[model samples]
Target: MDIRQLSYFVAVYEQGSVSAAARLCCVAQPSLSAALRQLEQELGVTLFARLPKGVTPTEDGEKLYGHAGRLLSQLQSLKASFSQPVARVKFRLGLIRALGVERMSQLLREFSNNVQGLELHLVEPDEHCDARIITPQLLKAGEAFQPFWHDSYLLAMPPGTPLSLQAEVHLADFEQLPLIKRTPCDAWNTLYPELVRRGIKADVRADIQTIEYALGLVSAGVGCALVPNFDTLLQRQDIVLRPIVQLKLERQLGLAYRKNQTSASLTVLRQLCQPVP
Candidate 1:
């Protein structure tokens, strides 16, 4: 429930014996055992399974072990940060929209699960921020960009479309193909001009901004759409995403932060960045 209780719990978990953990913590055996009981009651989780010899941590205890260690470490670090009572650290993190829902959710779950005593502010890319997950172009002067992952742009077509039969879509294949035009996309900017230069008149079906909605149109048999080959889209049974042959288009995304400023919160923010599964 508190720092002392967590310390005792960690000791008991690691030592695997109540009497030994109590001795290590310099507390009486009954008092340390009582503290563990109170912590378990407060958390509503059975932290340890008692045996004749020693204790074994339950699945719930194993899950809480890492959080307890980090929280204790975080508290220890705060001792050098200030001489008084510590308050929650607020972190402002900006993110661009339409990074696949599944990937973004996984990244955020890692951020939320690992750390305590921190508050998060999620906002748009251009807003005021401590750090932002975005592409390099959004980097301002004196800001540093650390590249993380790249997403490929592919043509999304409704199920059973004749073009979906092709192994890889070509530029000429887009000629007169009913299309869902996703605007403000860099890949579209490059691919559309070439389509225009070749005198390929794309059958423009719809003009939309967000890729999430564009995928829906593709599923409904409205038309083919050009979208980043996000896992959520590529794996969907209702739509097919095919990379354009000989035209390599990818969007690189990463973290951007002030050049010379590194706070504890920024370090924690950077640690949360993970590879897409």
Candidate 2:
């Protein structure tokens, strides 16, 4: 089976409809169907089970799908590598709000200047939930992609807050004060239950969306809000970031791309962000 056939198959599996996959793949339905058939014939196994609503991968198809995804990622990476020289490496980066936009851009600029032939394409996570919500989609699309950094979460408070200088603060201490929080929809949702377990109910004084807004609330003394330590924007003189001594609130940041397609430039980028051993 050709790469085109595998591409069509994977698209069908992901989209759940041949017609939808056809639209996404920019190929006619008939051609996509024909390719699927050709692929099944070559493998001598039934890859999908036709149903009234859509196609589902058969057991054998499921097994092949995993391998097919990795193979395609490698092929795509190879194509990208061949098209660009070492001095012109193209990189796609996804950043969550934990890493402020200004800091991310600055880091990318420095990274590009340091690495020869490096181009950076940066995408911010949507609604701060992209790391958990969208990362699986990226992984399924290509297993070769991996994240490079893991940023720990920290609590942000107005400069004079009593807890500002402490290395960490427990949920109980936060409950004693007013809180400004990202809505339950934010990625920090994963940490909410732990707060509840500590017998602390978030006394949310304001519900904010973006990190800038949350920091703004903290600066205004609206309440303390949890933020990632990597956010340089919140590290201003007016604001104080203190590690959560008891609650290790944290998330990871990293590079992801087709695994086999990892380039020398990408390696350098990864090395720069590598955590201390």
Candidate 2 per-residue lDDT, tens place, 15-77, comes to 667897898678999999999999989889998877766776788988988999899989978
lDDT of each: 0.81, 0.67
lDDT of 1 by residue, 1-277 (tens): 8999998998787666788779868899999999999999999999987776678788899998899989998987787478655467787889986677645755664575455666788998889988888877678898888777788888889879899899899888988899998877768888888888889999999999998789899999999988886643443567887889867778888888999987876776677664445
Top candidate when judged by lDDT against the true structure: 1
Q: How do the predictions measure up, each by TM-score?
A: 0.66, 0.52
- Candidate 1 global Cα RMSD: 12.6
| TM accuracy, model 1 | 0.66
Clashes (N, CA, C under 3 Å) per candidate: 0, 12
Q: Relative to the unseen true structure, what is the Cα RMSD of model 2?
A: 18.1
Q: Which parts of model 2 have CA positions greater than 4 angstroms off?
A: 1-91, 101-103, 114-119, 124-141, 145-147, 162-167, 183-187, 231-235, 262-273
> What is residue 99's positional error in candidate 2, in angstroms?
1.3
**TM-score for candidate 2, residues paired by index:** 0.52
Model 1 residue runs over 4 Å out of place are: 1-86, 274-277
